[model samples]
Target: MFSDKSCVNATLISGTKETCSFFIFEAAIHWAEEGHRVIYIAPKALQSPPLTHHDRSNPSTEAFKLMRFMYLPNYETLVEQLVDLHSFASLPNVLLVDDLDNYIEDPGVKDKREVHIARLCAILLDTMNACAVILKQNVHICVSISSECEKIYQLYFDKLWKIEEEDDGNIVKVKQVAACNAANKTYEYRKYGSENIILKQILYSQN
Candidate 1:
């Protein structure tokens, strides 16, 4: 789990749509069950309603909110979407973006591309950071990006995890690519069932 004022990026590399979807769904439920309001934003095609095991009838328990957007002619970028939902900042929330990389690519020339990318990055950073401040801490903003666009998002994340299938093809490995003055080793993926996935760090003995 991430602490307050933290922006974590998880790049799903070589993972199928179903795999990534399961992870996001699991995360949503985990956070929501812990009494944190969850706001999930993603494309319509990739959006799935989170399954909450908590008692929703209890008004004391927090609720989950799903915002699905279509990639239509009027589709807005992630920044635009977040700006509209800023009111939710009063609650301890976990904001999840399923595929931020979806909007990272735009056709343009060299100089133009660089400028466009900067603008996009600015919007994401500003919106999320503002929420972190307004929420008065304990707001987790998780962005799921493809490995292809990891470099672009790396600029704004406090921590980043890269997930890819192992060469043996029997498991997936997640590595912490960036951290604060710490070395992060590899974590092996373990699947107990379709919905239960765990990442256990591998420890090497110093001989």
Candidate 2:
């Protein structure tokens, strides 16, 4: 779908919880097909999955199910999941990052925590020009990141959005805010939109 397109690179941050939660994955899937490595900045507090699974005789493994589905079983535990960094860096297409600020300002940690996380994100940002998907929980964290990466994605996200608790204390918000760039390029504000970017795919189907 993204055959003839060489315009500005725009990153869209969905605002609503439902949209923010799921839209990044869909964006990564779409962009990877076009050869962009999706570095997912996983949320600080990821929402827990619902309590529902088949009683298979085998072990109750989420990995097993993901493997069964289109997604490959990435890793077992959190530590293993960190290994995904190497996988994303080595791969030719999309990459999934659990969290960019894993140890940025973390206390009781090693000396390299800040430098390491910064280096990792810098590496991914430098590696690809297509787009990167960063998902952060809560508004403060997201705004902090957007501020930090402002220099990087100045040309990336044509639309940056926000999600917050309404006066009623429910958190379902979405708004397509306008954005400008150092290059003087302009983009339309969109609530839900997709660029022509694509991602790499499997050589063969599961079935």
Candidate 3:
């Protein structure tokens, strides 16, 4: 699902808010189930707990325990968390940030929005790189940003993914818009039952 480069592995996920949230939670669950620690950062708390494909009769408590959630309600808080990431005794295998555009478009930052956003991006990328180097391991950062802010943030990411849901609401499409080190591809997923989503097929690929 992500690269293993021993540096900053940043991915930008662009989509509607609902689609982005769904994908991020699914990805986090996937990593957690694989016995990897996952850290989820967001400006606000999730409306509901993540639902996975695991059977209700035998829930996976271990996976849930491996996940950590942080609420950084403002830009300053987010920056502080990133800057102090390396000081923590343990690091997660995957870091998920949701709705980053909200922080970048903070109401308090009324002037030089571009400059502020660029600096924030720099902090995020540089912090991740430094952590990777100090720990001697890959740092995977997945950020979900609104389409309007995609142009500003995409340049800092190694890969770009765009997601869309069909009008019927039963189908979702994920397209790899760009990748500096991987092939571009597209995939379709269909909602299964009430809460489960299953990958239907790979739509296409391009080098």
Candidate 4:
């Protein structure tokens, strides 16, 4: 509907880790259908794409493409090649980095991995787009990433949103966190249902 990925002023997502299936992939397809450029990447581990070079234009839509999706580079190869964040940040308008934990994820590394990965995350956040989503399956790691953005947003981004889980049981709802102007001035936070997450006053001041 909207071509402006930059309009993605904020995000609203569920708290716990959720598998982003074809349904979610279709959501992205719809975006591209409307002529929105996209850059999709899985986590370093899952980042092992089915394949980077394909003759097919629309792989997700094709059944054969589905099979193709299963033939991407392995972890060892990805680690060696997926180094330039600039190569990523500069691609298409909509970029999907799966396994937020893996994008910056180093299964057996130190902060050195985070230092590089976090820098990339910061770049994506700083980029002006309608929508930039980073998927993390690890709540602890997701929180760690959110914590970094929360602080970085303070000094850089005009606004920031931390999307997380609220209630793990009963029913699931997407949590929305935001930067608000209030007497308290503390960063405002709120949780909303998936339906309530449409582009609206999703961001508000707690104070």
lDDT of 1 by residue, 1-207 (tens): 333235423233224445555456566667776766666666655444322212223222343443223332122555556666666535335666665545545332234544555666566556655665666554566656564544555565555666676544446676666455667666686654333445555843221
Tens-digit per-residue lDDT, 1-207, candidate 3: 222343778888888787788778877877788887788888889987433333323327998898899999988788889888877777776788998888888887765877877888788777767667766777778989765544666667778888877947678788888555557788887876666777778976556
lDDT of 1 at 100: 53
The whole-model C-alpha lDDT of candidate 3 against the native structure comes to 0.76
- Against the true structure, candidate 2 reaches a TM-score of 0.36
Error of 1 at 138 (Å): 4.0
What TM-score goes with each of the models? 0.65, 0.36, 0.83, 0.44
Candidate 4 accuracy as TM-score: 0.44
| Best-matching candidate per TM-score | 3
- Supply every candidate's count of residue pairs whose N, Cα or C atoms clash at under 3 angstroms: 0, 17, 0, 16
**Per-residue lDDT value at 153 in model 2:** 37
Candidate 1: count of backbone clashes, pairs at least 3 residues apart or interchain:
0
Candidate 1: global Cα-lDDT? 0.52
In the predicted model 1, the residue pairs found to clash are none
Q: Which ten residues in a row have the lowest lDDT in candidate 4?
A: 135-144
lDDT at 28, model 3: 82
- How does residue 83 of candidate 2 score in lDDT? 42
Considering lDDT, which of the candidate structures 1 and 2 is the better prediction for this target? Answer: 1
